[model samples]
Target: MNQEDQELQTEKKGNKVLVVGASGLIGISAIEAFLDAGWIVVGASRRKPILLSGRTLEHIKVDLLNKEDVFKTFQKYKDITHVVYAALYEKPNDLVAGWSDEEQIKINDQMLRNVIEPLIAVGAPLKHVSILQGTKAYGVHLHPINIPARESDPRDNHPNFYFDQQDYISEAGIKHGFHWTVLRPQLVTGKIAGALNILPAIGVYAAIRKEKGESFSFPGGPSFVWELADADLVGQVLLWSATSPNAADEIFNVTNGDVFEWRSVWPALAKTLDVQTGVDHSFSMAAYIEENKDVWAKVVEKYGLLNHDLNAFIGQGHAHADFAFAYGAPQGPVAFVSTIKLRQAGFFKVIDTRDALTEALQSFIDRKLLPPSIA
Candidate 1:
């Protein structure tokens, strides 16, 4: 067996975990990873997740914003030993604009506190807590980030819940004698529909283009290097952080260990979806996806795919895609972050961006969540 496999084999099993935001990409990936590793998993979210690979994840419906509800719900799970806080709240209608909103910051901070404080109060044997942050923490949204943003870089003073939650967790860790790891990944890709992961939105866009008998063109503005984090890889890191000494109380920036320019990677994406790639055809993916819902429905019906209504299936993904693709911008931002710390810390996992995107897109097609590419 490989060293990592051996390590997983030796690790203790049957530790119960509470995965908040069970319906999201990272949460679903983490749940699957934990279950496969023999961890007793319970998921928390307002919406129960569909059965994962036929494994029925024990789920609890609770709103993280409702403090009393969160406390009441969590108090019952006294045996919970680990927490993966992957829940996120994005403004539904005005997704990007709300990122810097004070109310957004407050709500996110409270959500983290509501979940963790209650678990601590109920005296759950919380060994470790892992929460997520993204490129936004480095103020990438407002301005250019350091070429390769490092975790040790000075905080980009911003109106972000990441800071508030980090401060809260750091203090809590010291006070309660627990370990916490913060992961900041760039462009997380996964198969979950209606989550921030951009793969599904891309799938829908491809399906729509193929259905219209149009070439799969690069719809963004300019070429720029970008990084990606596979949801499964993020899950593995979460598992690593749960017990690895290197991960204890550490903040790590993670990616697929390589970079790709959208224009360069376009062919691979097109090949995976069996579509023909065209030259740069810059347009708003956010606007296009929003405008093509009826077309998506027809594609779904024609291909005998699942009924993933555009808005529900795409979530804020179209908007996130625009952000990732740098649509409507003069040039794409060079948003690369340092994963050296992550590697030096002993988690030596990596996946190519092309393969990562291929695997993610194929997953939806295999599940029939998205239509197969046009012949």
Candidate 2:
């Protein structure tokens, strides 16, 4: 077999994994990756996700915030040997404001505890647990982060759900005789739609601009260098964390191994979306998307796309996109996080950022969530 085939071929280790937040970007990617690697995957979320590949996904609807519901629902899955806690709770109307909110921290902490405590109580054979964090852990949202932030960097002096969840999992891992890994991924992009992922929001914006015969202008302020982690790559790392001895009870900062400015990549992104790039025009993605509901509906009809309305189609992605693009800011800090820790742990996989993003957008188009790029 060829090297590519060899790399893709993974031995099934007789593992059953429960993936929470199955509808979000990280969750969707982890599900597909685990299934491809020959693991029995059970997905859980409040809403059932539509797999982009149209594969049958075994799913359970459970709210992580509802402790009793989560506990009762998970009690039957005592056979689960692994868990990927990719679920998140964000303020729907004011996504950014919730970051520092005490209630947000409490809710997120409870969510993690709710899921894992029940599993432990039921005596599930959980060998490893994987959890997700982001650049926010480095205080990128509140202050400038250290250039090339390392996994060993001092914890940002901020009240964050990440800290609460990490402490809980670490103590539990020791007491419950299971391993845990914390992964901090930078600007994750993937195929899942109508969630917090930015790709779908960008695709819809481009399609709307195309429909209006306008250029897909850069809608943010001064550009800043940034890194990205492919959701698929993050999924693979999750797999590696489960079995790699080096990953047990460790934290990793994951990225695509390169960086790019938004302005530098705008042309390529626009080309991939079948739109022409225009001069930078600073604006808020959230506001723009909110104002273009009817236009998006018209685009959906024109393209024979899924009939989800703009709000349902965008989810909280508009706000996330605005944050990611540094909208309305005169300048933004260059945020880079080191992945050398992950590489040293022996999972040295990487993807070109341009290809990773373009391919993700193409997947959305193939899934009928975005209009055709060719047309």
Candidate 3:
């Protein structure tokens, strides 16, 4: 074990945790992580999960969007020692460009005021409340000054709902007397029992292209860079934030230490799948969609897919092709907190990026969640 892992092994452990989004990707793994550390976990989700396996775990049905449900849920579990808010109204695919700022703000603000504040107000024995914020909190469309974004960096000039939500949590924690920490994770990829993720989406796309004997090309420019963090790493960071004194009241950027361009990742994934990878004739979203729309339509029809509206299904507008292509290209390194900071403070656990990705992919396959083509 490295210094970070050693330090993590020594930190004080909390007794019970309330995971708000226990059914989501990050929440699922985080619940398990807390349980592994001997913390009693109470998971709240709109639907009871069929795949979660744990004897120490309890499940509660609560609608976070409903203030009454939020309050009732907290009242039921006021003795919980920690809280991890992984639930959000949006999904990763919601890339609609035409969404107005006011619409976004109203929805996010209500969630915080209705759900977050009540939990803090109850002021049970809560020692820590960890909120899972994401890179968009910094601004969804703004470019970062530094590749890896740090917690202290100035947020983008454009206001976003995530920023407002973070502000509410911070202020509430201060007034309600609980230690609060915000975890800002970028492009989280991991294995989930009954959910989809970016990695799986990419893998399924590649598998379909291969079955059709189509060449795969880098979707966008080669200059775009993204820092990918495994879900396990983010889960560990969440656990550490809730229990480690060093993380109290601080915001940390959780990301894979290494940065890679799509040019590298696309080819690497293609090779792993033993398929031909080539650039598309046109990388523009408009052109690609226009060209492949028929193909995708046929696939959806053949499979009898329930959610088949590509634009709405993917949460991108007609401009999705453009955003998809643009996000694919390497932009720059996203700045983030060095594990050294946490390690030096006596929390030392680091995840190997390659191992993390491989394990995540294998998990998809093991769970039979891989698309038929890939299987």
TM-score of each: 0.95, 0.95, 0.79
Model 1 over residues 1-375: C-alpha lDDT tens digits?
Answer: 999787766664647888999988899889888888888899999998774577887899999999998999888888988899999888777777899988988999999999998888988888889999988999998998898899999999888989999999999999998899999988888767786777888888888898889889988877787889998899999988888999999999989888888888788888889888887798888888778878988888888887556777878888888878888887787788999999899999998888888887887888888776544
Error of 1 at 120 (Å): 1.6
- Encode model 2's per-residue lDDT on 250-276: one tens digit a residue: 999999888878888788888889899
lDDT (tens digit, per residue) of candidate 3 on 1-375: 899666656653446788877877788878877777766788888876444453446888888778887787677665777888887664333544423356766776786576555655665776788887766666545555544455677776665676777787778777777788887776676776324355555544554565577876655543555666777778888887887788888877777767665666665566555567885543554444545656666656565544355543322222433453464445533434444454555555666566666566665545544433343
- Which pairs clash in the backbone of model 1? none
Q: Candidate 1's error at 144, in angstroms?
A: 1.6
Q: In model 2, what is the error at residue 351, expressed in angstroms?
A: 0.7
Where's the lowest-lDDT run of ten residues in candidate 3?
312-321
lDDT of each: 0.86, 0.87, 0.63
Candidate 2, clashing residue pairs? none
Q: List the candidate 1 regions with Cα displacement exceeding 4 Å.
A: 1-14
Which of the two candidates, 2 or 3, achieves a greater TM-score against the reference? 2
